[model samples]
Target: MILELVRFLVFIFFVITSFMIILLVLFQDEQGDGIGGVFGGGSSSIFGARSSSVAIKITAFFITLFLFL
Candidate 1:
């Protein structure tokens, strides 16, 4: 029973992480001047400079989590 419960929890976590990764990928800017630019494209804007890096890292994290699960 304990093993089955653990498996089910892992499955849930995997599914959640998969969805998060997909969303992060979609939100990421393409060619450094895509959808992400529309919000704060200016170089002076902190988000414009850092969003891509943040998104990429988060996406990678979720992908790794999904794989581990």
Candidate 2:
């Protein structure tokens, strides 16, 4: 019973993390006219210069969590 509960929780966590990663990737700016274009321009990053790095780290973390789960 506990094992099934754990499995269900893990599945939910994975789906939530997957969605978050997708949204995070979509929010990041590329060269030009990317997701940022939807809001405005890429003249400045909302998270500053290290935004891409931060996003990459977060994505990696989500992937790692899936592997462990």
Candidate 3:
């Protein structure tokens, strides 16, 4: 019973993480402007220049987690 519960939880986590990864990738800017450019490639950025690196790290983490799960 516990094993089944654990498996279900992991599956749920994997699905949620997958969606998060997709959204993160879609929201990020290809021109290195970070996610702030999704709305408008302007001089203003909500996450600043450092957001790109942060997003990359998060994406990597979720990908690794997905593989493991």
lDDT of 2: 0.64
- The window of 10 residues in a row where model 1 has the poorest summed lDDT is 42-51
C-alpha positional error of residue 22 in candidate 1 after TM-score superposition, expressed in Å: 0.7
Model-by-model lDDT, in order? Answer: 0.67, 0.64, 0.69
The regions of model 1 sitting more than 4 angstroms off are: 32-52
Candidate 3 is scored at a TM of 0.63
Q: Show pairs that collide, candidate 1.
A: none
The number of clashing residue pairs in model 1 is: 0
Residue 21, model 2: lDDT of 70
Identify the superior model by lDDT, candidate 1 or candidate 2: 1
Order the candidates by lDDT, highest first.
3, 1, 2
What lDDT, from 0 to 1, does candidate 1 have? 0.67
**Local lDDT at 58 for model 1:** 69
Model 2: CA > 4 A from native: 32-52, 67-69
Residue 61 in candidate 1, Cα distance off native in Å: 1.0
TM-score of every candidate relative to the true structure: 0.64, 0.55, 0.63
lDDT of 2 by residue, 1-69 (tens): 999999998899989988887887787546554657333355334345534356655755666676776
